[model samples]
Target chain A: EAGVTQFPSHSVIEKGQTVTLRCDPISGHDNLYWYRRVMGKEIKFLLHFVKESKQDESGMPNNRFLAERTGGTYSTLKVQPAELEDSGVYFCASSQGHWTGELFFGEGSRLTVL
Target chain B: GIQVEQSPPDLILQEGANSTLRCNFSDSVNNLQWFHQNPWGQLINLFYIPSGTKQNGRLSATTVATERYSLLYISSSQTTDSGVYFCAVGDSNAGKSTFGDGTTLTVKP
Candidate 1:
C-alpha cells in the first residue's frame, strides 16, 4: 500500500496570488486532515474530512483558505490572495477512522509566498 | 481544546545510549499517538498508545492517561533514530488531535 502523497512538493507564489495544494490519501481511508506549520511554529490543524463531508473546520485561520474533498477521494486546499505570513509547510494526513487510529502523513507541500 | 507540553525540548546523545522523552496533555480520555518526523519531514507513526504500555524493538511508549502524561523510551538509540518526536492527544468525543511542539533528539555517532 502506498502512503499519503502530496503534490508539487514545493510551491512559490507572490502575495495576492492563489495556490492550491493537493493530497492523495491512502486507499480506503475515510479520514483526511489538513494541517500547517509556519516557520518556527508548531504544526496546527486546519480542518478534517470524513468521506466527502467536512467533519471539523474549527482550526481554519481565515476565509481565504478553503479545503475540499470530492468523491471522498483526493483533497485540495486553496489559499487565496496568499499573504507572506502564509508561507509554511502544508501537510495532509489520513487515518482509517476518525477516532483511535494512527495517522499517515505525506511529505508536505512547502508554500512560499513572497 | 487540549494543551500538550513536551519536556526537554531538545536532547543530544551518543549512539547506543538510552533516553526518555515526555509529553503531558491537559486532559485526555483516549486516542494518543507518538510520531517521529524523519529528516525528510515525513511524520512516521511510532506508537498509538493511549493507555498502558506498548513496546516495539528499541522504541517503547507508555501512556498514563489517568495522570495525563506519556513517556517515549528509546533504548540503544541509533543514528537513524535522530528526529523530532511528537505526542498527539485526541479528544475521544471530537476525534480532533492536539499536538505538542515536539521533542527533538539528535544522536551522535
Candidate 2:
C-alpha cells in the first residue's frame, strides 16, 4: 500500500499570500491528521479527520489556518495571509483507525513565507 | 494537557556505539509511540510501545507505564540512525497524541 502523500514538496510565498497544502492518505484509512514543525520547535498537531468529518481541531493555531477533508479522502490545509512564523514543514499522516497509534506520515510540505 | 520530556537534547556517537534515549511523561494512561524524523523531514514510526518491551533488529524500545517513562535503545548504531527521535503519548480517554521535543542523534562513521 502507498504511504501518505503530500503535494508541493516545498512552497514559497509572500507574507500576505495564501497557500494551500494537500495530503492524500493511504487507501482505506479512515483517520487523517495534520501536523507541523516550526524551526527549532517540536512537531505539533494541527487537527484530525475521520472520514470527511473533523474528529478534533483543538490544535489549530489560529483563524487564518483552515483544514478540510472532502469525500472522506484527501485533505487540504490552507493558510491565509501567511506570516513569517509560518515557515516550516507541514506533515500529514494517516492510520487505519483512531484507536491505533501507528501512523504513516508523508514527506511533508516545506512552507517558506517571506 | 500532559507534559512530555525527552532527555539529552542532542547526542553525538560513533557508528559502532550504542545509545539509549529517554522519554518521560508527567501523566499518561494509554498509548505511546516513537518516531524518527529524517533529514528530508519524513516522520517514520519506529515503535508503538505503550508498555512492555519490543525489539526490531538493532532498534529496541521499552516503556514502563507504571513509572511513566520509556527508553529507546539503538544497538550498533549506524550513520543511518542520524535524525531526531520523538516520543508521543496519547491519553486513553482523549485519543490525541502529545509529542515531545525530540532528541537529535548524530552518528558519525
Docking class of 2: medium
| Chain B TM-score (each prediction, in order) | 0.97, 0.97
The candidate that achieves the highest TM-score relative to the unseen native structure:
2
Model 1: per-residue Cα lDDT over A1-114, one tens digit each: 999999979999999999999999999999999988898478899998999999999999999999999999999999998999999999998999654577788999999999
Clash pairs of candidate 2? Answer: none
lDDT of 2 by residue, A17-75 (tens): 99999999999998898989999599898898989999899999999999999999999
Query: In angstroms, what RMSD does candidate 2 have relative to the true structure?
Result: 1.2
User: Candidate 1: misplaced stretches above 4 Å?
Assistant: none
Rate residue A51 of model 2 by lDDT: 90
> lDDT per residue, candidate 1, B27-104, as tens digits?
765788899989987788899888999999999999998899999999999999998899888877775687899999
Alpha-carbon deviation at B24 in model 2, angstroms: 0.7
lDDT of 2 by residue, B1-109 (tens): 8899999899999999999999999986488899999887888889999899999999999999999999999999999999999998878666467889999999999
Candidate lDDT scores, in order, read: 0.90, 0.91
* RMSD in angstroms between candidate 1 and the native structure over all alpha carbons: 1.3
